[model samples]
Structures are given as structure tokens and as C-alpha cells.
Target: METILNVEGMTCGHCKAAVESAAKEVSGVTDAAVNLELGNVIVTHDDALNIGEVKQSIEDQGYDVK
Candidate 1:
């Protein structure tokens, strides 16, 4: 399964890396990709993953998830 989240306050490479790293830390997440230009984070994971948890992970990194 794949989930796309809109993340705010990501302005550069560091922001992208932080969001990606946080997303990947979520259990069951296989991969995470952040598009800085679009402020979107795409997460690839299994069905067992909860979308809310994924959002929280990103939020924990100080990024707003929408």
C-alpha cells in the first residue's frame, strides 16, 4: 500500500531528509520519499500500517502532516 501525505514547512534538503527518516521509522513502512517541490511525502508500506501512525511519525519530526 502507498500513502501520500502533504507536509508543511519543508523548505530544503534537510527538511526532506527529516520527514523521510521519520516516516521510515514507522513500523511496517517499507520506503519513504519526499518531494520538496511539492511538499509531499509518499510512503510505501503494508496493510498492517495505520495511516494515523504514519502521520504522527512525520508530525513528530516537527512537520505538519495533512
Candidate 2:
């Protein structure tokens, strides 16, 4: 499964890394890519991946997901 998350407040390399790390914490996530320029995160994961949880994780990192 693939999903794209809309993240806000990303301003640097560290912000990108933070989003990537949060997304990776989801058990079913196989891979994740973030585009700071696009303010989007593309994730590849198994069907078991709970997008809400993933989003929450990213939000916990101080970013907003829409």
C-alpha cells in the first residue's frame, strides 16, 4: 500500500528526517520518502499499516498533517 501524507512546518533537513523517522515507526511501513519542497511524504507499506497512527507519529514530532 502507498499513502501520501501532507505535512506542514517543515523547514530544514532535520524536519525532513523527523518526519521520516516518525513514519518508519509504523510496523508495516516498508519505506518512506519525504519531499520538503512538496510538503509531502510518500510511504510504501503493507496493508497492515494504519495511516492514522503514522500521521499521529509525525504530528507528535511537532509537525501538522492534513
- Give model 1's TM-score versus the native structure: 0.96
Off by over 4 Å in 2: none
lDDT comparing candidate 2 with the true structure:
0.92
Q: Residues 1-66, candidate 1, lDDT per residue (tens digit)?
A: 998999999999999999999998889999999999898999999998998998998898899998
Deviation (Å) of 2 in candidate 1: 0.7
Tens digits of per-residue lDDT for model 2, 1-66: 899998999989999898999999988898889999999999899997779999999999999999
Residue 10's lDDT in candidate 1: 99
Model 2 / residue 2 / CA error / Å? 0.9
lDDT of 2 at 64: 98
Q: Model-by-model lDDT, in order?
A: 0.92, 0.92
Report how far residue 48 has shifted in candidate 2, in Å: 1.9
Q: What is the alpha-carbon lDDT of model 1 when measured against the actual structure?
A: 0.92
